[model samples]
Target: MTVDTAVIATRLSETFVAEVTGLTISPEITSEFGRSIYEHYLDHKVLVFRRQDIDAGAFAGFGTIFGRPEEHHVVKLRHPEQPTLTYLSNQDELGRNKEMKTSGQGWHSDYSYKLVPGGATMLHGLEIPVAGGDTLFADAEAAFAALPEARKEFLRTLRVRHQYRWSPDRTDPWARWQYIGPEERKRTPEITHPLVRRHPDTGRESLFIQPRVIGSVIGIAEMAEAESTELIEELVAHITSAPYVYRHSWNPLDVVVWDNRCVLHSATTKDLDEKHVRRLLRLTTHGQPVTPSMPKVGYSRLSSR
Candidate 1:
């Protein structure tokens, strides 16, 4: 359980993931040390730092080492003292789980509909469910690499539109929970991003499909809506295949950082116990707006959202 205070990165799974240890992360940080921590994040798309019983200030500090920590558009869940961290808690007002916790019920890259979708999200586990409530992540890069050459070429030319609002068929409790203010709606609107995203820093091509929030795909003028839906279904299935996936079981003192640009994650909670609740503090690092024109591979056919 206890380890040396010298920074170490240990691979957790066969896929691109590592368990980070031996570093004390705090608000007042050194750039030299932070850069080394970030290098591990770059090498491993997901990093699990365990037994880091740090406060909110320290969590936000670790987040900024990668980039500027962004406030959640959802203002209600934000920590009073720290805007950068959001409390993903399941308890209702009186410390009971009478309400549904919907922050990450389905697989998604955080704030993907935004013009500049967030980059890396770090979550510190304040409390976790014993039986379930694990978070699962899928590697888009590996999924794309496994695709057939013809399918890869076709996807490169396509664009997909993502919307933050729930679909018409989504009659779940989250339909009301996800509501934003009228003025806020203007700030967050449907945006089209390349189906195949080129990572801004690495320039690595990834199968960038946010299945839960996707409204539609453009650029395939001849494709019918029904066929497009089927295609998207297939893409989601392939991207989340077991080979490219890792399921993380949380420990109370564990903190996990996942790159939203390269990974898709979902919380796995089959059922919640009303007796106890799950809670976590999360900080997000914002990335640059995705440019419509991807010049790396010369694929730029897109439609206005």
Candidate 2:
């Protein structure tokens, strides 16, 4: 299919998806362009644009049209001399595989580990594997709204802990917290947050627990663990249910922007040995921290490995 470069927004109503065509914004365009993009992001949750010809510098300049760009916390920052982009390939600078696990494989909001989680994320696909590398996004707001009244009420008063530790069975002990340096880990250890998060700008609640990092629901009794687990799983199921979800098959030059506050996304894996490499540049928006005054909910953070 031919992907056009003109700025066009098309909605995929089947899954509440919106695609914006011809995403390459000229460096000469006024800063208002970025603001317009942000407005669309808030309303649509997902924006897809095509920009095959623009280079990294041009992409960075385009990002500035939305808001101040921040250094990616996990991914290595792009070079100072060329501030326009960062490489997102599996291969390292030496052209060797970094063996970096793709973080987007599971459903998650971008950078929820941080005190200020990412608000939005823009990913430009530089290269794409032929098949099975599409990214899927689920609308958390829609998920929350569809919850049963009892479920919503219960979650509103509960809190969950978020940390960097991986699942005990899946993670190597030595590799525990390996994603973050000691200093960074200390600065931002497991923090408590409401299980249901309210968007400061939109005043809408979203299911905010990070199932991977969250240890347990605070104040829940030990005997109730089975019940708690079942309930949490149900909530996740609701969030990822059909009609509210959309999967985007990647194409070279496709740039997707999504609101981290309201969407949960995952990437499908492709063959590692394939000659073609998949690369993308991601830019994330920052989120405000949840305060104690917001709610009296109990939660527990897993021990630091």
- Clash-forming residue pairs, model 2: 5-22, 6-22, 34-65, 34-66, 119-285, 218-298, 218-299
Model 2 global lDDT (CA atoms, 0 to 1): 0.62
State the C-alpha lDDT per candidate: 0.72, 0.62
lDDT of 1 by residue, 242-268 (tens): 888899989897889998887888886
Q: What is the per-residue lDDT of model 2 for residues 1-305, given as tens digits with 9 covering 90 to 100? A: 11333345678655356776644556764254555565556557788876556766766776664445677443445645454355666555523244443545667776676667767677888887787678888888777877789878877777665665534343654233555567866776665666778666555667875345322122222326566666667776777778778989888888787877778887765344445578787665556675322442342211111
Model 1 residue 79 lDDT score: 85
TM-score of each: 0.84, 0.79
- Which pairs clash in model 1? none
Scored by lDDT, model 1 comes in at 0.72
**RMSD of candidates 1 onward, in order:** 5.9, 7.6
Each model's number of backbone clashes? Answer: 0, 7
RMSD of 1: 5.9
